[model samples]
Target chain A: MKEPGLEQPGIAVEVAVPVRRTPLDEISRVKMLACQAALGAVIALAWQAVSGRLVDDYFISNPLAIGRRLVAWIGDGTIFVHLWATLYATIVGFVIGSLAGVVLGVWLGVSRFAARLTNPYLLALNALPKVALAPLFVLWFGIGIESKIALAAVLVTFLVFLNTFAGVREVDRDLIDCARLMKASRAQVLSKIVIPSAASWVFAGLKTAVPYALIGVVLGEMIAANRGLGYLVQFSGAQFDTAGVFAVLAVIAVVAMLLNWLVEIWQERMERWRIVSR
Target chain B: MIELKNVSKRFRKGDEVVEAVGGIELGIRRREIVAVIGPSGCGKSTLLNMIAGLYPPSGGRVIYNGKVIDDVNTSVAYMTQKDNLLPWRTVRDNVALPLEIAGLRRAEREERADRVLEHVGLTGFEKRYSSELSGGMRKRACLARMLLQGAESLLLDEPFAALDAQLKLVMHGLLLRLASEASQTVVLVTHDLMEAVTLADRVVVCTHRPAMIALEQAIDLPRPRDVINVRFTNRFRELYDMIWDCLRLEYHEELI
Candidate 1:
């Protein structure tokens, strides 16, 4: 009775009506891009004008000050070190967590008895704020990159696990039956049918987990680490350097966007069949 | 040969027990194409499911090739209303799935899949995903996959019901040609009277719910009959009207 939220894993015939583009369409697309750029510029100009005049520089950093701070960090290469540290933890944690989640999800998905038995415990863990586990992770792994990775991994595991579990459960019974009728062995059915069927669902989880991995790494760094973007933000805030904090935040935003783009590329590469070009 | 001896099936929906099929006796000989026609929700599909060993009959037995089918009937290639072709795999890979399951090498699987795909008129579409193909093409791909299984028996549960009239006729011709060449026994379940008359050697009509045999008529059409033009023929019309008459009675009983 559980309908798949994702598209069905079999032949999904979708009509891709090609839209004819006229000069007006091109003009409109250019206009839209221009408007977006104008909006961003307006916001930046307004912020720059308001700082020190409308609000104290200490309270709200000016756009120019934040830009200068970013340039200074880049020139000294200190930004790269913090950036690499955060990136390392995020990537390592994402891989480990995603693997664990997929393994656990598939295991529970295949066996109803195990899913039912561990349902309460799993629910309890998911409900608890994973950030609260940062202190414990720090104690166990020491206030190093391992702690950041552990926190990031913990946050991502729950997210990917839930999506993967639902994906596996939602696989069409008819598809499985089709394989069985073909005399497919149990291992073949799992490998060839079940896993591929749940792939889109797993990718959906991975996409969302990108930002969450950053969040976990940042929070871990803020709580205890001497390195990473989170520590930079924390250190700048303590020193009352509002521009430095803003500069570090901007870098984090860029990193998050970069990670998300990478995941999107990975999904598109693997599931090119789902894409309709337009 | 597939035989159903007083086969019956019941499904429990929460607290209510729904008898899907009841005391149906049918025999399908080797290389024979039999079509089971009935009103919608009359458990025509349940009969095929039982024969495929997807569901054990609530009563009686389903015998296939001198053995009672207790588990999934690996000897039969089953195709349902939905194509059920894997979306991720290209048409060739989907058709070659059974051979891959049988542990054939990649080279052999692809070569055999190409031959079968060509047989189903889908040679040029081997590398395309199912989603990229049209409905009729996807059905052809599905049929190709089923044919590649090399099973002696084919259980088709309204496989061409979703296609247009023209497509249906084309599919009918393709199925007839392929089934006859392979000498595969086909049990086609459908409510389409014309399709039943056009393809089946024998048409078994079942009544409303708790499906039981109402009429069993044989089509004595000659070998290598044209599926499309045969519909316009006098004998085809006679057979169609005869089967429709039996189906009309089932519909009338339901209204009453």
Candidate 2:
């Protein structure tokens, strides 16, 4: 019996070489962060210096006054109720729409006849502006969370649907043939190959839909709702309270940042297995 | 045994009707290694695809074990030049794919996948995704996946085209060794003349578009060939010159 050498060429040389010897990349990252902080500080100071000087503070509220209003909102604890209401609508809509979209996308993606028959109609429906339909949704579902959820779900469903359809279509034919040769059934192929292949596309669409979902919620609230960030903004604007408007805007900004941060973490975890580093 | 009975294939794109393979009649006995050499886009893969039942021949049928194949042939396993491992799956999971299809339990499939990975010298790479591995490692993982299927017939399309010289020789040795264990019938399509002579029992040179069997040459070299040194032998050189003569002659006519 002959013994195998297993002597791989050049791979050993590659392993011997260090990945990144210098700290230049790390230093550059720190420099970028410091630059952003400095920019924010300058803007804040400039706003404070000019408060009630060139323009009346009533028209353009100062950062400090907005902060004070935010502190006051926190003290009364009513802010939590509004925040929860908005959050509840967004979550319910996102879940229902994303689930329905992926399921239908996969079904239509697999069937050429079904995809062809309904593609144009789906596109036409997606093309319709959500704002134009907001009033109808309110009238149909009433001025409650149901209307808000409907608005958000409609906005989210299409993005996920299109992405998933393309993803399923983009799956390599050779891979499917390879599996078929292995004697995999149709159900097995769909479950094990097609669905897993479409996952990244679904995730991408979900990420893009986040801002739009929030938009749908805020739009519904501004049109007829009793609570939410959008309603708060509309109420303050009506009363000519600029500081109150900025405070509500700040809360919305914070919530958006938190959602985006969570998505960033999720995206990192989902795509960590990617081999694009080389 | 697998036999192609005057098989032919044609593809249509708008007004363009292209004939890929024309009257290809061939036979591959069980456990025989038949190397097919052809020019680029010469329907070598098309012929293999027909035999695998992925593409229906326009004219004739393919016979496997004296039975005509009209649908996908599960008795065969195929490997193409491109590695098609699922990007989302780890190496172990990819290797265990066929087992999953066979409805093997998780622990059993994992155990089987690990053993095969060990055979392919990919033990530490079980957890790594296909995107993380080097080209050679990815190829090995693909081979491991094929190995787990336990299919008796294989249709290989330029399977080792991406490998370096030394690695190709090692893989060729491993392939021959593993092939003989299960009496696997391998129909390999490669551009390398030396590879054909060294690894295959018989070599078939295919003509340019509308491919037909231009020349069929048998390699009478003894078993267990040393892939690195076989090209030095007079018989190997003679076989190489003969096949190259046919290829060069056909290519010369294509210049017109």
Choose the strongest candidate by DockQ: 1
What tens digits encode model 1's per-residue C-alpha lDDT throughout B103-142?
9999999999999888767878888888888888888888
For model 2, give the RMSD to the true fold. 9.4
For model 2, the superposed segments whose C-alpha errors exceed 4 Å read A1-27, A275-278, B13-16, B220-248, B251-256
All candidates: CA RMSD in angstroms? Answer: 9.7, 9.4
| Each candidate structure's count of clashing pairs | 0, 0
Scoring only the second chain, what is candidate 1's TM-score? 0.94
Interface RMSD of each: 1.6, 1.8
True contacts recovered per prediction: 0.71, 0.71
Q: Write the per-residue lDDT of candidate 1 for residues A200-221, one digit (tens) a residue.
A: 9999999999899999999999
